[model samples]
Target: MNKQDRLNIDTKCINNNSLNSSQEIQEFLEGYEGYQHLFLIGFESDIGAQNCESRTGQELGPNNFRALIEQLQFPSSNSFYDVDLSSLKLAIKDCGNIKPVISDIEATHQKLESFIKQIRELSKDSIIVVIGGTDDLNYPALCGQSAYSEKLNLIRIDPSLDFEDKYRKQFDDLEPQFLEHHQSHFKMTLGNEIILEKLGEVLFYGIQGFKIDQDHLDQIQTKLGGKFQYIYFDRDIRKTMFDIQNQEQNQCKASNILMENRILKESQQIELIVNIDLTSIKAQNAPGVSEPCPAFGFNTQEIEDIAFNIGKQENLRIFTISEYNPAIEKFQTGNVLCSIYQHLLLGIGERLKNQGQVIVANEYEDIGQQELEQDYFMQQAGEHLQLQNFDFDPSLQDFK
Candidate 1:
């Protein structure tokens, strides 16, 4: 693909400077060496479908999401004055979309992995946000971690566990492995012994019990043993607004507590990759996903809260939003998608301020050599430790 063909967010969204010259988010687009917190990339590929029956049109997800970001209004100081939204915006560099070789998915995965490695080499601290065509895109995101070799705390916010007992065979056959919620590439990537050997921890959150294959989860849990954490699904989260009034307790708060504790502390830079499938949400809120379910999933606010919480982490190396299909609900899904992305920025900005690292426009573009060296050191140290293949202690499962 030619460089010109690669799509990115239009500059119009960031160019709004009605307040002042320095106030606009666009003023902060410092080339590579700056205070940028995110590198927005897209993976526009949907070749992983098992058949035409499962779903299509997810390939349009990235561009649709970009359009939503462009159309939405930016937040004001009244909403998030503590965080430097302008600086955060300046730090972002949309690298454009990666068009996978649809005929050969293996080649597509390799191309994506290579691209992610190049980005990691450019900046370790910057979060990589990969807008995906489908859930299979998560595999490439996970594989991208190999570039840093950092111990990862993979957090999957989905309605059901995507674990397959015979994942190895499915992968070998190159079948449409991730067509359904039950059979997903995540199963092969996260449940694989080879993959787990390199991971520090894996946690599954917001799972729906009825949708999952209990036997498959059991087998994966046994394999992962202490390396995994499962936050079981409770029916209360699926209650409608009216039903919530009758409920005795707030289910969201309970889940939030777990999310709050899991935020990677600055002291231990455990690499975080959040894979959020739009299907994880209630059908009413995300009807455009590849496979929407009316029966089980979190409400809009709950998923947004979860996304915001994940975005707030200092060690969030990668964040992927997948399976959004504009073909389903068109504008309705588009608006929901925009809200999710906007809230994520707010959360990240708040955390940056709390960490006492509020980025100024000028400070973003002119990063010093000392700062570069520190980032490099951290990346190297993480790679070295990953090579050691250290076993995660069972005590790390405190969230359980």
Candidate 2:
């Protein structure tokens, strides 16, 4: 990495009018530059079949990846943004400084364990951006920091809920069909990578149309308590026809989304993730995948806007982006990739708040002066206490 490669978004952007983020957001990004807070992590399995399907070509290879890193443009970001380049390269360069660290999990189970451990150790409350070999990887990343299995707010904004116990649908379409229907309930299916511990743990937004089975519904309602929230948007079916209220309250305002039957009733906080699978975009923008769907605006810029807002919230602890198929859309892929990077970068700028260090300037003098002050106070307190015999009873309040 060169001097030009790093991006301290918070410190640099304080004066810029272009990227207006809140103070809370400014603090998040300021401290985020610490090694403990930034990770450009990639994950893939080495099973011959799975590896070929998931990891083989999906990586931010050295050259192109470096280019992206070298191009990040934050306010007064050490002068590199001034370097000359065409609009395209300049745009590609805007992705925040993403340090590439690919985790290619070989067939061995130990490798997975090692990868997870290293990531947790390295992440000191910093953001871990993993290039997913499959959507399933989110489970481990989230669990790595879970507090005794207690649920935190986790949100998955994909077109569909790609929640499967097994990868294969028993040589059947039930799973594939389910995948399609799930998309109808979502804007797209970028991160079908979900576990069914609780439908409440996940929230599906941008859903359009869905053909959910009764059994699935029962499972969610009975077993999972229908705790998750789903903002289903059948765009082609309804096509978000109203913008009359440009006063759009939120992304969910655009479509006729179905909220979870019971989760809303209970009303608890959720963990949120916003995933965008490539094929969700127009086949022309991002093509070829195990599953394909035709729907525009699934990448609907609004989703990104929603993502920025969601990404900004103080409660959102983890942020993950997956399934960017470059092999499918070469020409446009860079821009899409750039957008993903920019969102995370700027979002990092928005969430990784760093309270500038508090330098206690009068170190020696301050410490000596403080000790003298403490002695004077202690002596005065001793005299005051000598006048009375009293028992401290603060802790006994609870007993009473």
Candidate 3:
């Protein structure tokens, strides 16, 4: 198919309505009046995995995730966390899948980049969640966001670093058959100077040290300079989690590894993009990826925590979950992904609530003393009280 034809949204999964009357999320789909808080788009392509000679079937990731998520039921008010979810009124829109050109990888990237640019321009305030076919799609996602942002920061959660230096003699000597597919997986790395120029800081989280070549690591370090930081699977992640636990108990200062890495700092002003490769999780937890880490990786809960923390960042612009292959999946990976998405949404809700409070406080500060007459003050107080009583739709107030 031509590029324009490929840009059409696949709505098969979206039109499949839930049968349960009590379904909370299904009610928020696409017909809301105000701004949508979340926009879900799928990049449907396994050509990257095919080119890289890894297992294919990630092309089905988006629809598979949707089929499972549609079955979920929101917790009732009497449950453990007894908050009234119906009152939140969050809206989510599934824009459906972007069909990819199998024969031309570059064309696929171009189509995705253009489509993402449109989404960003159309709804600058919305959280854009991309369901990916493979990690290579991350390159286009980053490019699309950088078009509108002056400075960008990236956090890549993966088991092995995907950097491969083309200039190295070892790389130059490789056979053409091996070389073509090998380079398909390296687009997200710093091998491209254009991508490097747009990035202000980058963190390679959940990296397995043994899986990386020493030369590739050294090469990335040299190119990235002080802008690069990494958290190792064996050495650092566990300790970071321990530090976070201690901080929560008030036994130590409030510091997190992400905070130390500078990605989660609320004061930072850069637009952030997070790319999560499912293979970063242990094989037992996420066996449905192109490449599974059998020996060591993050557990499901740890990955959920990471997602929530990343979501809470005020500057998070785009979040991509990639490398999910349903062909080899053992039935649990889809559920794990759905849980991660829910946690991320919760984090976003918390951020919005905090910002709403600040906005209310600022309005109070802006009131002039002369205007605070007895009757006027009472009227103003009543309005503020009414604001508290109003149905809280986090998307109603523009945080931008």
Off by over 4 Å in 1: 1-34, 50-52, 74-84, 87-90, 165-182, 190-194, 235-255, 260-268, 359-400
lDDT of 3 at 89: 32
> Candidate 3: which stretches are off by over 4 Å?
1-36, 74-85, 165-191, 239-255, 357-400
Tens digit of lDDT per residue, candidate 1, span 1-400? Answer: 2211111122332222111121222333333344544767677777664333457777777777777766664332225335446544325555566676745666766666766776666566778888877677778778877557647778787776666433222545676343322245766675556567778777777677777787878877877777676665464343433355468444444345445444343324777788887887889888987778887777777776776777677777888887788767767776777777766776876776666655454543344443456459869987988999887553442111
Of the two candidates 2 and 3, the one with more favorable lDDT, higher being better, is: 3
lDDT of all predictions: 0.63, 0.39, 0.65
Ranked candidates, highest lDDT first: 3, 1, 2
Error (Å) of candidate 3 at residue 298 is 0.9
* Candidate 3 local lDDT, residue 75: 19
lDDT of 2 by residue, 1-400 (tens): 2223222222232222222122323334443323224434444321212422343333332223334433544221212222211101111111122121233232222333244444444333444454543444455455444422244445555555553222323344454312211122221222323434422344555543452344543444554444555555554313443442344643443322322223222333544334555444444444533344565435544434444444344344456555554444433544554455555444334443332222133433443464466559868887887878666453432101
* Model 2 lDDT-worst window of ten: 84-93
TM-score of candidate 1 to 2 decimals: 0.73
User: Ten consecutive residues with minimal summed lDDT in candidate 1?
Assistant: 16-25
Residues 198-272 of candidate 3: C-alpha lDDT, one tens digit per residue:
888888887888877778777777888888777787778666566767778633211246555666663368888
Q: Judged by lDDT, which candidate is best?
A: 3
